[model samples]
Target: ARQLQKILKLDPKTEVFLKRVSLLLTQIAAGDFGGARRRESFEDRPPKVLLKDRPELTK
Candidate 1:
């Protein structure tokens, strides 16, 4: 989470930053950041990095 804040130039302690990160992780775990139907339009979908930090959610 700290690394994500740094990469996005966000303040790690801020609530907004934390919320956005949480949502991103939720999207990743659900296996569709923009839903399965919309994902088909994406030419390059990156793998979820959150999986490394919270592997259990993938189940």
Candidate 2:
């Protein structure tokens, strides 16, 4: 594949990807696929995190 690309001069896909992303963002801005937005309040954070202190996970 690398040799084929070197011979044929393939272009990178960034422009195509960015175009699709911009369209998706436009849809999102117009609420085409919007779900319930979560609160950004600090109180929404969990009171305790359980996974960080697992004794068996210490290396």
Candidate 3:
């Protein structure tokens, strides 16, 4: 979670991205990504855009 916190510090909007990445990491760490099923779908938006639209994230 430290890495995710660091990424959040770099760009707070990364919360969503970081969450998804973290989830993926956890799944991979637990050896669950090798199946023929999808875990979850990440938003189709960019972090910068999310930050721009939701400045509250920088807080």
Clashes of each: 0, 0, 0
Off by over 4 Å in 3: 1-12, 39-59
Models 1 onward score TM values of 0.35, 0.36, 0.39
Per-residue C-alpha lDDT of model 3 across residues 1-59, encoded as one tens digit per residue: 99997755766566777889999999899988855454233333436878899999767
lDDT by residue for model 2 over 29-59, one digit each (tens)? 9886444443344335533443355545433
Question: Top model by TM-score, which number?
Answer: 3
* TM-score for candidate 3, residues paired by index: 0.39
Cα deviation of 20, candidate 2, in Å: 0.7
Clashing pairs in model 2, backbone N/Cα/C closer than 3 A: none
Which residue pairs collide, candidate 3?
Answer: none
Winner by TM-score between candidate 3 and candidate 2: 3
All candidates' lDDT scores?
A: 0.73, 0.61, 0.72
Q: Which stretches of candidate 1 lie over 4 Å from their true place?
A: 1-13, 34-59
